[model samples]
Target: MKSTVADEMCTEDLGNVLPSVYKSVRLSVASPPLLHVNASLLLLTDEALSEVFGAVVEDSEEYQTLKVLRKGGITSILFSRPHHANVLDMKMVEELTTALHSARLDPTTRLTVTAATGRVYCGGHKPGLDAASGLQLRDGLHSLVKCVLEFPKPLAALVMGPCVGVLAGLLPLYDVVLAAKGACFQTTVVESGETPCGCCTYTYPRLMGHARAAHMLLLGHELECGEAQRSGLVTEVLPTTAFHHTALSTLHPLTATPPPALSHTKQLMRQPLLNPLTSVHGSAIMTNTTQVISMARYFAAGVKRNSDNAP
Candidate 1:
């Protein structure tokens, strides 16, 4: 049903009236992201959609590409731009870095979970990588990946759908990854090319074998939930119907574990991967910068030559 409310009505009137019908969701943004009855819901019924989350979660801070939500000890970093397939643009990379940073600093935050709003969990990085934009993307991704690897608290991913592109590579790095039965995981862009994908190069090989990692990195083989779980990239394969409920239930146990034991175990587990990932990450950035800058110069020279010979 369509209910159009005036400006004053959205904040005040909606809040008072929402309790009964939308008891599970509450939205407080100036431009309400959605109302469950919102227009986008009509368009995205087939896709993985973010419900108005009030019933399932609570207390959120909205940013350009994310919603940092809190429910008790868990801080859920949600990719909020489902319409755009939740691609990792510069804005998203930066917000992810910021959210991770905040989580790292918050003493009360016992665990962190990453989930996206769309059917395509992440469509990967935004396309078109010029020198100017590419460097920002590189650095932003640098910070974001490092933040994920270095994150002291538990880092989890609830994959309700496909995770493709660079993001597909990063999944192996998360502490506990849970994928819905329908989910697929794999990278597409770096396909055997000299794509300086630093993180995945180190991560996938270590988790799975080098041969399998090579296949994943070069061939873009999609791993179904069971395959991913067997590969050890995912901790569990959850049934789609009960995924949200089961995924949340599985994580609640982590909170009950002693904080120090969790902390030390996380630290010990990540320690070995840190330095290698950093070295690989830095090398990829250097390679990409060199390629992008050289290509820029070559194109510039050709443009100048064309102008000089102009009629």
Candidate 2:
């Protein structure tokens, strides 16, 4: 088979890069294990772990918002623009959509993970762009959300900090969400005078129940890591010190599973949501696009007023 971008990116053998990390620890069922060392320490030292995870396979050439990293059977899409707190701009959305589509087509890819490298996972859409730009932004975001929803492989998120706005809205789409102690989640669309996009209207209620989903979407309630896990929005919460190791452990299981079986299982599990998700997706995009255009006007007018009043 011809190598796709994902296949090309993941060509480096992880086994060669970190031999010690790839070795399995032996445990005897009947007797105490010979080694008394900490299991976490045996996997990889922090420095080695960082080298493995932080290795960038594809830098943002067209899309400055994120980078793609591949190791073993896993492909990680990291939101790279921490300067804007990894905010989702139109360009970012388009880039993400293209990446997702590429991953979908790659047979070598078994699992996909989305993460952020800053204090925020995603800060929602950028503001103050023109109405036409806002519409393009909506279209781009809608396509990205659709890609995530219909992704064949299991998708996971490692949230290390505050996950706000559209990023929070995407939690339910992920098969698993590992959050750090400092991580928090909020859906800000309704509070911002916009309806929820990303099929959040359907996904949230299914994952967290109508009441809690209502609290988040309608009342703008922010869930701390503990609350998010309790509400079923987060799969696990780890201390900042342990978050990376724990996230690796969580995704390690999927590497063992056959890709075709895992993909089919994911498809079966998401089958129930597909119809409703499709039904709501179009309207959600339309409503959000209209609201974005209007909100842009409001933001521009406020900026003009401030400028006029100054000095």
Candidate 3:
């Protein structure tokens, strides 16, 4: 991918500023004498910052399912396919993985934020796939979740509507989850006769407790925003009118922190989960993939049976 002029300038600015910021953070942590050092001096000028952050990079390539917009050290990955209810099929999953990968490499992006268009954050998996496409979808979803887990920078999810299926599975992986009023979350894997993917087996229990996780995954419970917040699944819930503003305000602190320190903190916090998650990721994905194929075939047979018996 060719770097745009704005991207190049942002990279240059980050190159100029990050080393000094990293040094200051290191010094502040290592030696008491340097604790009072001013880190703000390393910040880029307002004009340069505007130029770098204000640039919006639309996905013009093969995968146009999402838009990547950068502003003030934050990269917002907005779901673009409202017509499809932002379903995470194989193709969209691949695109999301690629976007996250690019954001991870982008020097100016200190944090990544995810949001979707329309009323549903994600409507769930693409329906009715054969065994081959099911396996492909499973792999793509696994890759997408892995990218989110391994992303060095902080990850935030801004939920303005219902978040369901595989997308709901990803909520626990986010560092911060800000939901708008009326937003709900549910995992429909059981309903579909498939197991959970994206390490939800591990993350849901940790984030929302064992009982709630079991209730959700096993019984297919839908969690409203308040219940989600109480269960610790959501960081906060705000009015739809104020969600974007509140989310930005909440993320403002990260801009002041050194990127290295932020990344290090995120890594340390995630290390324990990562260890167990790695071992299970492959097996879970494979199991779910097989289940998806089987479920599809079963449903197809049932539909055929009904059609044959119908008038």
Candidate 4:
């Protein structure tokens, strides 16, 4: 019997890599376990995390990293050590979400999910991280959409990054949201100077209307915090210094909600989005999985070709 590529990779090899098959689960709480749910902030490696941030801020990778974390039951408050970039890349999302889902299944545990980033989280400097070419980006988004559509629990996001990209649109799906001070929102595929794809264009028309959505997609203008609030994009904004305090406030209320209520509310809210979107999302994911395997193959081939070509 032949071993599958997935079977060939060990958990160690799977970590810290693009489209990581092995998800790393870290227990962040310091105190002894409690009956009530606690908050979990998910993040990625500096380079990987930075990639997601930069793509949205610099290039617009669809800001799907935040989408992924929220799906898996964690409110991703992305923070990177200053000077280190905080870009939530695909591998990080996968591992973090997998960890969250795993933790959620434990009868004793409960979690509140939010997404944010540190001052400097980035993927490495390489075209491989490009959103259009990003196997991991698409894969990660696919995972989140699938999970979110059918998830038996509530999820939310905190958008605070250069490129709020797809996250702003997705935030409306959540029961609650908090946008950081100075955190601007935009769905522009042009002014952001990044090529906007199908996903970027869909949200506005679906949520608002054709004319409004077109203004956003075509003008490439950003919605400042106030504008975002007016547009119903952001629920609230806090001074950068107050992000933690605001998070505590947002999460505390969430923690107090009974698990069953949270789960039920999440399901009901998701029905409209999930009903029409599931088949499309499912097809995309299947395609994404295929692309990942193919990308991995090409990656391996390039290495071999390089070795053979080298003197």
Best by lDDT: 3
* Candidate 4 structure quality by residue, lDDT tens digits, 1-311: 45332223211121243112111111111112211111121222433433332212212243334322222223343433212223345555565456446435644334545554432122221113333456556656556545444546555555543333434434555556666555555442443223333243444566667776677667655556566666666667665544545654566666566888877777676667664565555554565456545666676788889999999
In what order do the candidates fall by lDDT, top score first? Answer: 3, 2, 1, 4
Name the better of 2 and 3 by TM-score. Answer: 2
Report the lDDT tens digits of candidate 2 across residue range 70-170.
77777877776555556676778888888778777877778888876534466566643678887777777778888888988989998865566777887
The regions of model 4 sitting more than 4 angstroms off are 1-84, 103-109, 120-133, 166-169, 188-202, 279-311
Estimate candidate 3's alpha-carbon lDDT, on a 0 to 1 scale.
Answer: 0.69
Please write out the lDDT profile of model 1 over residues 1-311, one tens digit for every residue. Answer: 44533222222333333212122121221122222223332223212223422224323443767766666677877776656556678888888889889888987788888877544466566633456876777678777877776878888898866566666777777788988766776664443233636388877888789988887777656676687888888898876554556787889888788878998998898788778888888887777667657666666788889999999
Worst 10 residues of 3 by lDDT: 21-30
TM-score of each: 0.76, 0.78, 0.77, 0.56
How far in Å is the alpha carbon of 151 misplaced in model 2?
0.6
- Backbone atom clashes (below 3 Å) for every candidate: 3, 0, 0, 29
- Model 2 residue 138 CA deviation (Å) reads 0.6
| True-vs-predicted CA distance for residue 165, candidate 4, Å | 3.3
RMSD of each: 10.2, 12.5, 15.0, 14.1
TM-score of the candidate numbered 3? Answer: 0.77
